[model samples]
Target: MTNPPSLLLVLSTCLHLLQWILDKLRITRLAQRILLHVLAAGPIPQHVAIVMDGNRRYARGKGKMVQEGHGDGYMALRRVLEICLRLNIQCVSVYAFAIDNFKRSPDEVDALMHLAENKLLELCSHGNLLQEYGVRLNVVGRLSLFPENVQVAVRKAEQLTKSNNRSILNVCMPYSSRDEMTTAVEGCIREALAEDDYFTESITEDTINSHLMSVQRGSPPVDILIRTSGVKRLSDFMLWQCCENTQLHFSKTYWPDFGLFDFVPIILEWQRSVWFRRHDVLFRS
Candidate 1:
């Protein structure tokens, strides 16, 4: 029902808005460069786990639709991924969707699935930033439960980046710590039964680690776990991997509002911890 002139105007407005956003994002590039230089002086985390929460709440607070908030959250994720890639983080794991998240309203869940599929397809295409960075894509979870189209998209993404070896991006879609652990345990039992001495000789923590979805896909043990929207609990994400050695970070800011500034402090804390440990050892020796 729209006329040609009006449509052109709308398109122009959108283009201008997008350009403005791009400019604003670049405004932080210089700062990011300086920050990365500072970070290079210390050890960077090999594996960083993020529990992205509060999209619906962000939408409610801003009078926007839930899906809009999620879209913004996706944008935030892209920025964080860029930072991780720039910092040369070995493994970046994000909890995009949990198995229990299926309990959300059907409309919201459908929206999320569609959004995820579209974003994934876009990211998998050649010449994207992820491709440029040589970041391998691993969607780690119970993927069989997804819709056929979504599964296809996920497969395409994984196939597209399977050759990338520089860094890893683990999208924990519809994953559950409990389910992962149970599956690993079951697999171990099966293997033990198949091989008489396997249970007695081979089954150990490392064996179980080899069976976990993310760990098997190539992510290392989580060095830092962050939950946004001020959440303090692990919320069933990476429970086995986020052990005593892992630093836990809970930010008061909403996920969509979290940015480079918010994340830098957490990394700094981890770096400080590393330095302190090294200094204490040297002093004792």
Candidate 2:
């Protein structure tokens, strides 16, 4: 009681705290509405692709190891998968490890490999919740480079959920869009030669796309590509397919900090944009 803050100081402090509380409440309400509407309207994405970024930066910010950030990212992904199921999303693709990531320090690369190995093993033993939801698991990208054990686990998970049709979850490991395109070209060349067609003449955009690694069984084109960590670059993920009016949602938050609730607002924003784009023909007038 001997000393009191100036009136201006006290008012400013109270105002700041009040504003913080209001912001938190508003965000909470928005998240709740987003979830409810997503479930009720079911305007879910046919295909959703994600670029998980910022693990190292997040770790640095928290004074933690990069490995810990990656571990946290893995757990966050599990939560998002559940959200995808609840939203009735038909296909979800996650960019796990890119071919360019191999350029990182040996210790970091080792940590990533270890994480993949452990996750694969766990998926093999426990299985995904996809079955109960009729979701199928698919692994895309260059799998020949993975360790023998990891490959086996990947194949096992794919086989276990091969017949399910509720949704498709595609995990891209060691993926490169250019490499994927080249591989598709190779496949087309083989198919053309098999039919006695000229390999040189048979390669076309459509031919190559037909052979690219994707949902062989009615996989929908990606409608939205979400990248975390404020990174504007696509990093060679779905490079050829995303050029035409595909919506992009960027988050400053690191991948590890993302959760089911965080995605709700993003989805809502995407939907609103889509609606406007679709009706722009009339609305612009």
Candidate 3:
């Protein structure tokens, strides 16, 4: 009879298999890196806005509490912020809390406010990623709608990071696109009256755009808008800032589940569209 394989032979066979698996993994990773670099070669978007949605749904699906869902969503936001920094995106605006969200149950609203206050404090802390990445934080919504303490925390965060120049993070709290447009109109009228004691020049798109909350923070119009939870509608977020060419991406993944890998495909698609558009223009010319 053939002798049973020696212990040394079995051990060697296992080692060989392990080595092959490790090599395959390394090759796969290198291929992914190459693809990512190729997708990133085109014009990077200067500003990106995201509507972080479905925190409650995600929590319920996982048999967790709403607060836990919100907490997870916060962690996702932190990760996405880091990813934006890595991508060299100059500005990011998130639909954190809309004005209409006040219609939620009182306890839920209170929990959200508490979460926001704690996060603002954390963002303003010394040597946090906001500081490390030189990110300026701005609360781009009506401050009076929030609790006085929340307002104070937001102002403190904004003041602490105002000097940073590497990037801007705009948190939309108690914000509505209609309300924002109304506020911009009022601001334009007030400025015109202050300058000439009357409306001299006709109101133009630039007049309203210049007075917008995002514009005041020196952020350009949104280049791409990604909404989670499979939401395709704008939902009153950044109406004026999403220009005609703004690439809109909707991901079925809930906000709490979103990660860098979910975002990479969106960027790749946007880059492909940009390339096609440029080629079309060349053909027309």
Candidate 4:
């Protein structure tokens, strides 16, 4: 005959069960508001980045088409953005499409382009959700590669959201850190060469930083980066920006399955880290 589960075991089981429920049905808005109040009492990161991965895996796991997974991933972005707006996060960057994504099958790439165009246009319809939230949108990447019609939508979204000042959302499309860095370096070189008396001292870290895509997009350095789908790597993402003073959170849940409950706990952990760091508490202990 076995005894009843220990208190710790029972508590752990309950927490796990709660997480299962939260994954399916998110905690009510009132609970989210309480979490936000707690977050507001602590030091909040100025900038956040997310490497949204595993959309296709999520779709496959749910017995849906890969494109449907991407569609759901976009919906997840909307949810996260709403949370960010409520939290007053200053800047948020998301990996929308990487440069390497062009290597996907022609049909898939075309589908993505269509989806992007539709979404951008949708943002302009109705009362303009982004405008109402005062969230500025910046689409950063190699823009010339996009088809003409898609480019029109991109410009429209940026224009529509330009008047907002409350927060910034940067969507990186067909982007690669290597390409961004190379472009910045090239820009610096061209400027230095253009000036007859250019000195090596003038090309400082600040100058190069000013030329970075993030800077041009008006995003500060990343304070915290969260990657979903349980992946650990940055995958040629904002490498230089994330190199220093960035807290990395890797979630086991796929991007589509990830929700606010999964996010707030990670951020609470970040808040704790920030508190300890400010107090000079050695992490080793």
User: Per-residue lDDT of 1-285 in model 2, one digit per residue for the tens?
Assistant: 422235334544544454454346645656654645544373556788899998889999999999999999888788788777777788888999998888989999888988987885555344457766787777888889877877887888778777887788888888988888888888888898899998476687777777888735456678889999989989899887674867888888899988754576666656555554545554566
| Global local distance difference test of model 2 | 0.76
- Estimate, for each residue in 199-220, the C-alpha lDDT of model 4 and write its tens digit: 8887888888899987887888
Q: Give the per-residue Cα lDDT of candidate 3 at 134.
A: 95
Which pairs clash in model 1?
A: none
Predict model 4's lDDT versus the native: 0.82
The parts of candidate 3 lying over 4 Å away from their true place are 1-40, 196-201
- List candidate 4 segments past 4 Å from native: 1-26, 281-285
Candidate lDDT (C-alpha), each: 0.85, 0.76, 0.85, 0.82
Task: Write the residue-wise lDDT of candidate 1 on 201-259 in tens digits.
Answer: 67888888888988888888899999999878888899999868899999998999988
**lDDT: worst 10-residue window of model 3:** 2-11
Angstrom error at residue 250, model 1: 0.2
lDDT of 3 by residue, 217-245 (tens): 98898999999998789999998999999
Clashes of 4: 0
lDDT of 3 at 142: 89
